[model samples]
Target: MDQHAEATGRTPDDERLVCARCGATADGPRPTWTFSMEDGRRRYFCDSCSREHLRAIEGRLDSSWW
Candidate 1:
């Protein structure tokens, strides 16, 4: 990876992630972020997406993922 790529740590794929719950996005992803299934789907979550699977996320809804 280029130094700039290593420094800022963003890639084209980072923008491809859509939240599993709100159908939106989470925070920026790591360059090597891989896909994982939590609720038995071929999808992923931004930080806010945890609302669907994690009670803590819903309990802490006041917290901003942004």
Candidate 2:
């Protein structure tokens, strides 16, 4: 998925969210995904990516720093 696509804050026409870290796709607006606001844009991460980077997330580190 294109990184710029996430910044646009427009959900895909199909309403799926793609992970910023891994390009994984999921039916969005779901509770299982990890959502973050960075650089004033909404970013979503799939469950696997979120679990792998749980500590970095809790530390409030920028995803770019991870």
Candidate 3:
């Protein structure tokens, strides 16, 4: 996906949400994949949920073990 797409006020397929931390497709709104935090904070996670899931990762060790 294009970085400018989000800045241009464009949404994803089927109301998909992109993570603010990482630019990965988040869970769909329908069926409500969103999880609530203990502090009353609502957030979402995506394919980029963990640092170990990166593909062409840089600025780290040769984490091919993941």
Candidate 4:
């Protein structure tokens, strides 16, 4: 297993959640924010990106709309 997997106790595939904007993995040091889409798909965002796009997220706008 890779170092990241070892550190997070999850394999790369098991840590599938990634920031929809920046593509940062959920296993990174920064926290991740998750939102459930209307269609029931879960979207994740890194802490930095989450803070940067807080308004749009709270407005219930999709990232594609930004």
Candidate 5:
């Protein structure tokens, strides 16, 4: 298991890492991106979705805005 999954207490086989935007499932080794929200919530994103919304993410814009 990767460090992120281990730290989060979730195994790779677990489908808990799901993209908050596109609803894509992270069933592989790891998620494409993991965002630590200001409210202390963790959000996951798939590769494609991450690339598509990179600007918004970096700008700290909510997924709902995209």
Candidate 6:
């Protein structure tokens, strides 16, 4: 593991996640962020966007429907 991964307990992939909703980028794992799998692809959502669509997310709705 790299220094950042060891320090943050995040994989290299986690260091460059882009929010599916807002395009917000994160360099580390965020406790409040959300991760989802859609159409066989991985997706991430930032805290604000996740909160904004909490209900939809809880309902298992796709981001497109939110």
Highest TM-score among the candidates is held by which one? 2
List the candidates' TM-scores in order: 0.32, 0.80, 0.30, 0.61, 0.59, 0.74
* Alpha carbon lDDT at 40, candidate 1: 36
Tens digits of per-residue lDDT, candidate 3, 5-66, equal 34321254455665433556644443322222322333333444434444423332222233
True-structure lDDT of candidate 5: 0.62
| Candidate 6 per-residue lDDT over residues 1-66, each given as its tens digit | 344433333446656756777778777678999877666656778899999999999999978898
Local distance difference test, each candidate: 0.41, 0.79, 0.39, 0.60, 0.62, 0.73
Q: Mark the 10 consecutive residues where model 2 has the least summed lDDT.
A: 1-10
**CA lDDT, candidate 4, residue 36:** 35
TM-score of model 5 relative to the true fold? 0.59
Weakest 10 consecutive residues, lDDT, candidate 4?
1-10
Better of 1 and 2 by TM-score: 2
Which of the predicted structures, 4 or 6, would earn the higher lDDT when compared with the native? 6
**Descending-TM-score candidate ranking:** 2, 6, 4, 5, 1, 3
Off by over 4 Å in 2: 2-4, 8-11
lDDT of 5 by residue, 1-66 (tens): 465553443345664666666666654546356654534555566778879888988888876687
- Where does model 5 exceed 4 Å of error? 1-15, 28-31
Which 10 residues in a row give candidate 6 its minimum summed lDDT? 1-10
Candidate 5: the clashing residue pairs are none
Runs with alpha carbons beyond 4 Å of true place in candidate 4: 1-12, 28-32
Count of backbone collisions within predicted model 1: 1
Comparing 1 with 2 on lDDT, the higher-scoring candidate is: 2
> Which candidate should be chosen as best, given lDDT against the real structure?
2
lDDT of 2 by residue, 16-61 (tens): 7788888777664657788889989888888899999999999999
Per-residue lDDT of 4-64 in model 1, one digit per residue for the tens?
3222333355644554435554466634333343333344444444534466444433223
